[model samples]
Target: MSTAPLVAVPAAAAAVPRHVAIIMDGNGRWAKQRHLPRFAGHKAGVDAVRRVTRAARALGIEALTLYAFSSENWRRPEEEVADLMGLLRIFIRGDIDELVRENVRLRVIGDHSRLAPDLVAMVDAAVARTAANTGPILAIALNYGAQAELAAAARRLAERLAPHEIDEAAIEAELDTRDLPPLDLLIRTSGEHRLSNFLLWQAAYAELLFVDTLWPDFDAEALGAAVAAFGRRQRRYGGL
Candidate 1:
């Protein structure tokens, strides 16, 4: 049986969701179905990113988080990994100016120590360039793993507490997503039905929406449907 809730909210409500998170899945499968290389699907997925970002901004969404690259992706073929990094660099260099023009602020999360120095530099430059934008914030999770993030947060909290300082608030303060709002709607593309360690802590009570469309094929209409579905949800937040 489906575990999804059936709550309803009016369309005119001013309290629309402030954050939307997505797990872009099915890139490799999309490529395989076409007898093309996996990187082609990834390239196409980048185009979807642009479309979704534009759609989110138009919908008055305050923040959008995209699960781009996870720590587990490092286990993939070396050449594919290099190509993904290259694609990221290309996107940063090619899209920053346009993103700034659109008033979008680009923020990245996850461990960057393993990234190539040049790529890291480009990401940093892009973030700095778009820092002053007043529009919707775009957060890309690269080399990110929710489990690792939580473990890291726990370690930091443990370091700060001898014994007396241990508390939920303290642990929350140490989390990497502390500065970000809790997830409002979490969407996963490619028909996947699992969290896959995307945002385990932050998505505790988020509405989950799944679509069978591949990441590369995701567009504005699909995004609109997700928002509309969210509008019909009655978010009790653990209350009646």
Candidate 2:
């Protein structure tokens, strides 16, 4: 992390957010409203991912974390699950060059043990190939569930603690997001008004933004509007 200042400035002049997290919601609903298969909406959502990543990079945002798949999603119909995984494979195979060209670093955060070996390999390749990129870091949360993450963090802490090393800081340090900055802003689209267990620990102080646009339709303009709204708020961090 940089030692740069967090000086407050006019909303228009404020430095772009260092970290932004998004819950890509409403894909199935979007497709339903259009009388299309849910997978179609998911596919459309992928295009939105490309657009928002470019916009975030252009705006100089340092990190963008997207909730691509949650652990709960595994309970859905097997066909839908298969479709989503297929899309992920296609993305990894076809999008590597574009990602490298854009200087974007791709990362996957979540348990991948249950995923097919081929998909796992693809994700690893994407992360390794873009590891050196200097542009915005894009983290895709796949099979990620915040409660699961917290449990995993606790298990790690318990394994290391000999009853003397237990502390709040120690537990926090064991979290997966220890290296990432605390979330500055969290956005959820499709008019949903809940966190859905995304970034439960890391979003402790993040400003929440909700938009009516579905994931497939979310674009740069929507993002800009969200940022503008965030700029107007007073971030007290529990201080008066």
Candidate 3:
């Protein structure tokens, strides 16, 4: 699906949001509609990732979180899931050097125990390699679910603190995104209208946008237009 080509922010638009999150949706649907294998869409989705990552950085977004793989995604057909994993491996192998060149810090949030050992190790290696970069962050949400993240954070609090000692701050400190900036704007493509359990905690105050553009079709224009729209919103954080 095509989107607005104009990304030029008007004077009325506010400063760019610092932290942006995206639910990259519609890969399977994009493939199905094109009469191609779903993995074809996923492969193209990789290109979209490259485009969006560069756009986010250029837009001065301090942090960019992408919903790469979800915990629920494992329920898909086993062969498809395997294909997704294979894609991740190839993407990392092919793209990590570019990430380094871009000065983007790589991070992953979610349960690592369920992933393949080699995959986890590879991801860790990539993160470690990019640990020194000071540019905009690129957090990949792999096998991540927000509700599960909340529960795990709570579990960590329980392990170290008495019930009375555990407070909001304690729980917040244990979240995977504890050190990241507050979520500013969240975008979901493919015309999806729900969060699908991605970043439930961090999105508490995020400005939300849903676009009809499929993930594979998303590009700088789509993302810049979303960011510009976010700038026009007057965020009061519940204040009058």
Candidate 4:
């Protein structure tokens, strides 16, 4: 049985989602398909990130959250992990100035306590330098897990209030994404149909769009198509 919801929003009246999140997948698969090194695919994925970020900014998206690295990714081989970190460092150092110039606010959301000090410093520098930018927010999730996020939020909520005082609103406020707009749409590439623990609490009512295009191959056209599909669906928030 399909668990998908019926589309209620008319195509003509559909508006671009205010907040969009993406689970970038299939870098390694893309590399294997091309008979190239996995890092090659990851490098290409960085280009895709640049393209999508610029496109999203041009399209006036309020907020864009990208699932960069998950807590589970640490289980990967040390060599691959090192390559990923190197790419991240390169991306941060090479692009922070440009991001600032374009007025894009950089924000990293996830547990950074276990990260290397240098990596943490770079991430902090990016955020700090762009702290005053009033443009679109680009939130990158690193070492993030939706279940962990919810669990942490619950822990915080429990510490701040009595059981009787806790409610839906209180829980929402305690979430890591409390300051951001509600997630409107989530897109996962590489033909993935599952959330994979990305933004579970924030995506309680978000529309999901899955594409077969690998992350490295994703381009502006891909993003446009997904957004168009989103526009065609009506979000009733469980109401008629």
- Count of residue pairs whose backbone atoms collide, per candidate: 2, 0, 0, 1
lDDT of 4 by residue, 203-231 (tens): 98999999999999997777877778888
TM-score head-to-head 2 vs 3, winner: 3
Off by over 4 Å in 1: 1-15, 162-164
List runs of model 2 lying over 4 Å from the truth: 1-15
* lDDT tens digits by residue: candidate 2, 1-240: 111223222256463567899999998999999999999999999888877877776666778999988999999999999999998888788778888887888887788757998888889888999999887788999989999998988888778787688877887787766666668889999998999989988888898998899999988777777776778788999998
Instruction: Give one digit per residue, the lDDT tens place, for model 1 in 45-82.
Output: 88888788877776777899999889999999999999
| C-alpha RMSD of each candidate structure in angstroms | 6.0, 5.1, 3.3, 6.5
- Measured against the true structure, the TM-scores of the candidates, in listed sequence, are 0.91, 0.91, 0.93, 0.93
Please say which candidate is ahead in TM-score: 1 or 3. Answer: 3
Q: Pick the candidate with the highest lDDT.
A: 3
Question: Per-residue error at 232 for model 4, in Å?
Answer: 0.5
Clashing pairs in 3: none
Count of backbone collisions within predicted model 3: 0
Span of 10 residues, lowest total lDDT, candidate 2: 1-10
